[model samples]
Target: MKNEPVRSEAVGISEEILRKWEAKGVSRRDFIKFCTTMTATLALPLTFAPKIAAALEDKRLPVIWVEYQSCSGDSEAFLRANQPTAAEIILDIISLEYAEVVMAAAGHQAEKSKWDAMEKYKGKYLLIVEGSIPTGEGGVYCTVGGESAVESAKKLIKNAAATITVGTCASYGGLPAAAPNPTTAVGVRDLVPGATIVNLPGCPVNADNLTATLVHFLTFGKLPAVDAIGRPKFAYGKRIHDNCERRAHFDAGQYAESFDDAGHRQGHCLYKLGCKGPEAFHNCPTIRYNEGLSWPVMAGHGCIGCASPGFWDTMSPFYRRLPQVPGFGVEATADKIGLGLVGATAAAFAVHGVASAFRKGDAMESDKVKVEE
Candidate 1:
């Protein structure tokens, strides 16, 4: 077994940092509330709020974010995060030692900074890989500092405490591995099979999940409990359909057959249009994107199941039902439909039990919360 991190608050927030943030219009109260929100997101006891506060204040943990075969969408999502805001993320959370897209330094300087940080933080820093690794042609498809993506990841991840695969690309090869998969793109787990990796998959992952996972790591000094695919169970435990806002409509058999139809305008369930929520596990419905404003389904689009396995291929034919899933099959009996709905309803109730642990909480307290436009 690996040795656990010895917890301490020695590196917590300093007065100077607080003063700097205060000048930026963030009051101490707002800061505490944000910490409380992070605590909520982690489903940690309220008592742990102060602990999270202390950890963020400490800011001793270093992170190295690398992009491989990707569109940099995940990095953009991280920067656009609204719940706590990206500025707050950079100033208050983990020390981002190196990132290819964001760092000011480039060329040899950027490469030096990364290697230096890795050497300095060895076996302690968190490694975040934001894209898939292309193994084709000696991994010549994607290179940084003259090193292939596979080579770079292998070098860095080996010395890190834990790894986080931030987007569908990094998690499961995403679009890069779709169809013929010319690049032979594969996820971080496949490339570094021995490393402990937490996959947060989506076209561009929800930033809140990234924040919560980081908090969990800081709080426990270890990785959070994960599903079979190495997704944190706290975040990926429930099927999106189970907690969808249109679930009542689905239960009542009010489905929209087309985007232009009256049912869609009426906010009917998107099952008929091939919503993949039933088979997908993610908190998009509850977490929503852009500071809890709205999600794809809420916007009248069927879930493409971006967070599910092999989504690019398996969840395709975007506007049609998947061939025939087990419970929601074409030949399913009436009893099966009733049982499925009943189970979905029951799962809906249980979702809160887990959701409350880490959800950003405004919704937990009030239904009056409006989506940010």
Candidate 2:
């Protein structure tokens, strides 16, 4: 018998992308798996995987990534993505026209590249801002190519189709806008009012979420739905507590009181140790960082609500408990609430059992009467 040649499963995927993936040792299965993962991350149906693949095959998205006042932690996180390596993302997904840290072009040449992209793809390219804009000192605090951060942001925002702010610094002013706010730093939204902006607010924004957000735009030709705070609902829809691994501990009132306690070692809930999971809305527990290896909570540390607005000040005193849980009162302890829920559930079941027995008895009595008749 003759052997059959292996058929390619590249389907709608472009040869260019396949070649790049092949060069990077990414298989067709791996590419599909990545697309599926992205589909789930976007909260889209699994059937959307093909659509996502098709979208990736379309024209490479023109993206202009700009940074101002930041530690570049978000950029670092973004570059560290391993599932779909940074090279794949940069080369296959987006035509990254301008980025200061990674681009080979420097000084005047770099500035020219950014300006050229903005002009060439006006109202077409996506703008990703990575730091806060300094409004103080006439915006002299942060400048790029002799242009003030404010001026640069205004121009970029004006010409781009939409702006995506990565990290808390770019979304809500972060540490730069913290107490005493020396630079009078503000986010891009503050600098360019009334512009369409998607805020991915985290100390170091999760790269997976950023990739998914871009995929959603490419697949649907529009940004994903956002919450009241301009954050994608798929990424920030539920509180971290809702899906935390220690949620069972929280519900059972098994809490770690101190860092050195036995409960801490046993993986008890860190609610008492200033975990803001109950009040913080993010997908950290589910999506996780470092390619889903683990998150802060999984590593025995509590979430500091780094994704929340004004987290620098509000989530401070990071080693203390929240004033109160959202629905429960300030005085109500987890134990009390947990007990109440258990008791209520037990009571409901007991009542249902008794009612069912009575109904059975009544039916028996009615049968007896019919027999006598």
Candidate 3:
């Protein structure tokens, strides 16, 4: 990503938008603070924070947000971002041309606005898909503007600069593609092959991560470095287990066997209760949710591995630790192995102490005789 600031003229944010911010009583300083916070969240140095501000202030990228088979939870998460505030996000971050839930236009008018923005921005616009694309029965399961999810995505993504699949539904087909999926739902990667795609896979994706991603793109004119699955490294680099508040309990072989147990109430590890944290990677622990307040584990719930692929099928049934163990003779649960290893280590140390004492006694006795002679 480029370290230098983008020229104001290069960005598309309008003076009218700034006026709207002013009218809403949101100060310029508050907006800059939001940008700086987001830049830091992206793991970029504070120096790049101003660059982010410039990008957001001057070059507002047009976004066409489309929803398919979803509950709009992802949008709700985005709206609840406390730093930027939902109004600022709508009016300042990006030129949100059309969204079904947020836009005042309905039916044909709303669809027209989306197409108008698409034609105007064409290769420059960003396409954000919020839900899954159903392809069963000729894509008849889900429709917007009288077009199937598959058909709309295929057409709109053709000239888009990048496509972001928000939420697990759009990113990995989520719950819709779970057991006996009648809709034959598929993610954006499958629907729009070879397209520049970023998958923010969560039951409801983190709002801060989404904003940080857009800021990174604005500053660098390209998407941030991503992992194999197109997840931004800064956000999904480490497993939740690595930063869990109850990690000490896990290392000490202490775990909550059930939800209401004393161990759980005492804030012990929930691994035995089926936390997918060991196998899941996301910034949920660090960045957290709802203004850095808390995450699932902090709230006394184990991670369901919502951010990882095939989470619905692979991570469940939730409330039990992962079962598969590699590099072992027999299948062993983490708790069983942890306790066994601890016991074995203690036994070995005890045996070594006994042997060392005997050797020391023999050497001391010989030295005493030499002194006497």
Candidate 4:
């Protein structure tokens, strides 16, 4: 268990010059405003806001965010974060010197940028890992500049003040990590021993969580408090179902039976259809998606539970509640069971009818009783 970092070094931020001004660069007032926002995001003391401003002025911390085994969805998601126009946010916050996606440079030039950032900001920058690392074939599954992503991340994370693992693909093995896990993908924690890792688990983790974590780190010079699994409690503390709007319908035992069923029209709970909100942790319901517009459940789809550990495997039966759905064979189907049962019942009825006819003949022929009787 490594200890938390104390505030920025005393002489570091408040050096000889109080303010630095460049006509083309960010203004002092703009600096203070960003700092204040950082303070509010972290819920820190007002007094510390100035410290944040001073630190940015004193030193521009480099941030290197790595990608692996991902569709670059994490990058797409961060680009789509609800606030801050994504572009301005990245450009304004920490000196994002090496992201291949957004950096102006390309090919060999892009590679050089990363090397420069690593050299200049060693032991000071932040490292954010966005996907899983392949441990197979010496980590050859994914590479940048001919070096394995694992190797690249290892070099970057070693000197970083802290590392943030965002999205389920980075936090756990994710979909690419399903069963065969061809490349044996692993998370940052597995590769970077003893480094402080803050895991934010989700398909595309709530962007606000990422921003909030960054703000907390900047304001306090330490990773925010984390839960046992290295996830920040603020976002991952509660079960989605606990705060979901459909929870009331769940408690009332109203459920959507099928795609266009009556219950569905009424917007009932989707647990019967394999919603994993009760088992997964996230702020999806609270924060929603598309800048607080709506989430899966709110959009009428059951939560696929992309945030929970091994969700692609464990909480499956994608539309059923049963944990281990019976798999008779690959060719099995519900219609098969219904037809099989119906056939057996019909056979049994036929046999019973024959037996009754042979044994008694209704007991009327032998007695020759009156027609009415």
Which candidate tops lDDT?
A: 2
Instruction: Assess the local accuracy of residue 235 in candidate 4 as a C-alpha lDDT between 0 and 100.
Output: 76
At residue 139, what lDDT does model 3 achieve? 98
The regions of model 4 sitting more than 4 angstroms off are 1-60, 322-373
lDDT of the candidates, in the order given = 0.76, 0.79, 0.74, 0.68
Q: Give the per-residue lDDT digits (tens) of candidate 4, residues 342-362.
A: 233224335554335224334
TM per model?
A: 0.81, 0.83, 0.80, 0.73
Error of 4 at 354 (Å): 38
Candidate 2 local Cα displacement, residue 117, angstroms: 0.9
lDDT of 2: 0.79
Per-candidate RMSD, Å: 11.7, 12.5, 12.6, 15.7
TM-score, cand. 3 vs. native: 0.80
lDDT of 3 at 58: 52
Give the Cα RMSD of candidate 4.
Answer: 15.7
